[model samples]
Target: MTTSNWLLPEHLSDILPAEARRIEELRRAMLDLYRNCGFELVAPPLVEYTDSLFVGNSQDLKLQTNKLVDQLSGRTMGVRADMTSQVARIDAHLLNREGVARLCYCGSVLHARPSGLLADRELLQIGAEIYGYSGYEADLQIIQLALDSLALAGVQNTSLDLNHPGVSRALIEAAGLQEQAGEVLSLLKEKDVPGLRQLFEATTGVPDDIAAALIRLPSLYGDGNVLTEAASALPDLPGIRAALQALRTLVDALDATSVGIDLADVKGYDYHSGVSFAIFGRGWPDAIVRGGRYDNAGSSFGRARAATGFSLDLRKVSAGLAPAEPSRAVRAPWNSDPALGEKVRQLRQDGNVVVQFFPGTTQSIDEFVFDRELVSDNGQWVLKSTN
Candidate 1:
């Protein structure tokens, strides 16, 4: 049997009318919120040279990117897997502002494969980034904006999970485990204390203090108390101390009930140079928002600047919300009468959805509920409520 023409590739699908409308509404609301907060919107192209696209990104991002050859220039190009780097390039080269820049963007990003078994290969990614600011204050603003974005979408009970890659990187480097950095990072993410002990035991020349601290990193998760516990449990390395202090600042500033500490989170360790965060809603298995500081990402772009931001897949967030309500609309007749035509135009101009039905046919769409109709009464057009 031949394949159906309508069949889509695995993990790829189209958004139907109802879902598309909801996603679009969310896109506008999020962008509006960002604009209200002084972030100017910028849209990067969907395709770009691989050299520029992959600059300052992590290996995982490279693997997620889909590459193709440009027939015009014979150069390699890539469909963006993430827009953060592109936005960073804009801040470094295009805008090139001296003091600070606030940018926001919303667009589709293609991934070589689904991030999870049930995830789609295409994502409607929306986020805001702040460049040229090094202080944790920038981080705080980004995090708050992320939370507000969720709140605007009616998501409640969101808990923010915070991590700093420097804490683990410091221990690993101090122990001279650069060669085994990948393995160490993996173990830290899994929080496999026994596995960590086994690796450290087999390896020679590892500092006992470093090994102990790395092993302790995984359990240092919980509420604000985790930070206090870490200060005494881990070594007094400057990097480690700095990481804890950053966490403390956020904890003291944010609502304590909605924050949690996870020092062993290695999710963005390679990409994020400072405190990274993931916001999870109640009953959701994955993070709804992911962002942090990556000051070194713009280095390859020829200008290094302080950067921090957070992004969320709009489609994913929309998927978790309740079904969108059908828009109330007025059904109008397709007629030659000037009065009827004028009335329909006024209704539509007044923010009413007026759908004109064909003279001899009827059509239906789930996107709209025809609650009212324009009827001719005594040669005068008037709106009649159907509900």
Candidate 2:
């Protein structure tokens, strides 16, 4: 006996109509936001050659993409786990002649389910990537644009925690524990401060200075005060100093009170050779949007292009919007004379959701029939209730 009538894979989720509408509205708003900023939107197929997945920034993403052999060629292809890599591939191969490309994408990206609803494998992702720019100004602009996109989605109180992957990479190499990079990063990603400390203790040939710096990375978050503290704390490490200066420069450029930089925060895509950032807001488990400079993501396509962009989880943004409903309080014409029936019928032709109640005939979303002058010409649009 088949006990299960049907089952959906654990990671998949459905977007209902109202929720889907909200998401679509957000997508339009965000795309328009980017389009206004000179970013041209492009989309890639859901599946592609396995190499396309690996030749980008995400090391873990390649393994997570859904894969199967193609029917005609008998070659393996994987569903993209992220859009950043795909867009980069397209830019390098298709738009290579162009000096730079500002690209955006909105669609579903598949990943192996991560044992949670929030990290569902089958998910809707709306994101963008800016490629072939050497300037960090491009990075700053994209991050700011991401914040704007979130604001456009009606997301409030978003915290933009900034970090430099190059800083962390330098710290790892400084500690002479480059092999421990993955373990240390895992700790940082989990916000496991104690775990990171233990990793530091486990590391051999570590300078006391670098060990201290590595241990402090996870807990560093706040306002401008956080950056000041980091400035004093990491005065000697070249990587940390460069990161601080970069952040200071970014801060000087930004004129908004809503944006803040967390100096001690370290997070990013692995190929973010320089700076990285994430955007957090209400209704999102972690950051609702994130992206960074993945210059090397284009190398797999045989071109070296610097890139930067950010994206919001469209489905999550959709989750926050209130649903809309059809109104049933439409007004219908009222009359005391029997000859007024024609007038009522004519009013119905205006498509005003008119309701005319006569024996065996009710015309409209709401009901409207008999009423005294006191209630009849109340000068309101809503129909009077007979009951």
Candidate 3:
């Protein structure tokens, strides 16, 4: 036999029955929530042309997606890492309409990025997309869905970290530290305040003031009042200021207590032209839900419209919650006969689990498998319990 190691990298994992079933319940509950909000659900393929996949989300996902060549066409494709791009493409080409189309999706997604850079390469994302909608009302609807899902998942100690990408980009560029700011942000993302300050001090030739501002950015996280601090310190950075104002509006839109601020908490994508954020709760520093506005992503196709959505990572959500008890996977058809089926339904309605087998289908339900001699003169189905 060939030798192979059984160890798996931290990047990959398998969900045993107990965990998988819990995740399934969360997914179903999320979908039900989406449906109640009037959003229709659709599922896209796990694989799509690499060109098509990258076009909507952007070039960043290139290395993260697992690329392959389709057997029939031989054209290169990649296992989809996100569902947003595909949904955007569909809206552009298929809807071809003039009004907003609310679409939701749920599916398993694959990526090459390890769990550290993200939660897992193999992930499940369930969220909604609204096409042809640019107004803030659409934003409200999606946000409500996200809030509702968090409750359904039983997530606690949760805090909503909000930031406006538009403002962050504008601020960075305005400060004239666009390039180095990325590195500074990276250090801060790891919560490496010491490294961040050291990097700021070492990067000579950049003004000390800018370096100081960049270093100060990390500690700027917290509350509606934090905006005033960023505003005062980075007075010349209008890009950052405007971004904060938009954030201020979004925060004001919601009850101030419901959301929190993190001026330094940036997202992975530069395409988040407007507000961007991820949900974090106890046991999950990685986002349980992530979303932002992509106003120009669709322009790569043939249309331009603002869009934003957040997906609930059911796996991580379930991981953080208590392990639900295991349950049977397959259930018996009510019964072979119409009358028996009715009785089984009533039992199920009363929360009793029961399985029924058709009379002719190989001994009605595998109640037992044995030689014909096992049957007694008076026929009956019976088996000795393991107990």
Candidate 4:
């Protein structure tokens, strides 16, 4: 590659100072919010053994993970494309707590490929997980936390895309199309209605009623009324009915945030066995937050804990939101006076950013606005407003 092209790899770039500060501020605010919600923070490693990293119902992560050989061990290690599986390992093998464990994490994850057309190949993921709870209660808590997190980041006009894989899985199984279920699921997830109709027409032994419901899955997205419509349109199987009921309860509970149902919204259907949701905000073409219930995610690590959580890319979420005000700095002159040095120390102690000007070098205060400049007034240093 040429020198110019060597600056950054495709889909990856440096986060300059201004944006970096914004991201850091949001990260602190988000972690603090998680702490306030009784979620203890945990920092998992950036890379781990491929086997442990891709544990349990994580085929998607397996594909997205970038593998490398560890020099000392000569064993394959994978850069984590997601943190949930690692967190689950912590809960199952490391923590090993008896009752419910509420844990949260924030860190960067590397993906082998970009998630979307404009998505970043590297992302800073911030999320929380609840282990040992299987009911809608845990789902509701995580969903609410996701909304609150977005609000903290200054996101408005947000909508939640609620879904359940069980609803479609049940119908697919009932139709005896389990053999081609994977192909059908891919089509459903893409919302390729015309392609679905063609696929069903070509396939044999699918029941008429089941085929109709399968075709309807793509269109079953909208407001809360979509839930009622789904209940009426889809089969009365236990899984389908139970999924709809759970969604209805969630919708009712979410008073502040708007809710939409996508029966075929199977983004993580292979992984999440229960209620799954994606959060969207105004002007963002993709989900700002995505999370769901994955009860069997930790089975490979020794125990299967009912898990539900949400994760958002801090970079993407902060991109749509407003940047926070820059901290004001007090410009201090480089001097040998003890009292002047003490004044600078006191200003920094009081939570002000103090930028000192060197005696010999040329420095411009215009580079960044220094709200106040320290000047000697009759042998006593005092701050004079630049304004």
Model 2 Cα lDDT, one tens digit per residue, 137-237: 88888888888887787778787767777667777888877666777777766778788778767666888887887777665666556667877765367
State the local distance difference test value for candidate 1.
0.92
On lDDT, the leading prediction is: 1
**What TM-scores do the predictions have?**
0.97, 0.80, 0.81, 0.95
Candidate 1 ranges with C-alpha deviation above 4 Å:
none
RMSD of each: 1.3, 6.2, 5.9, 1.8
lDDT of each: 0.92, 0.70, 0.70, 0.89
TM value for model 2: 0.80
Q: Can you write out model 4's per-residue Cα lDDT over 170-230, one digit (the tens) per residue?
A: 9888988777777888999899989989988898888888889999999999989998898
Worst 10 residues of 3 by lDDT: 367-376
How would you encode candidate 1's per-residue C-alpha lDDT over 1-387 as one tens digit per residue?
Answer: 899999999999898888899899899999999999999999999999999988763888899999999999999999999999999999998998998899999999999999887799999999999999999899999999999999998888898999999899889999999889889999998999999999999999998998999999899999989999999999899999999999999899998888999999899877998999999997566999999999968888789999999999999898888887889999999989999889988998999999999989979799999999999999899999998
Position 314, candidate 3: lDDT: 79
Model 1, poorest ten-residue lDDT window?
53-62
Clashing pairs in 1: none
- lDDT, candidate 3, 242-304, per-residue tens: 687777877778767768777677765456777777777787767788776677567767888
Name the regions of candidate 3 deviating beyond 4 angstroms: 1-10, 56-60, 175-182, 191-208, 327-342, 345-352, 356-387
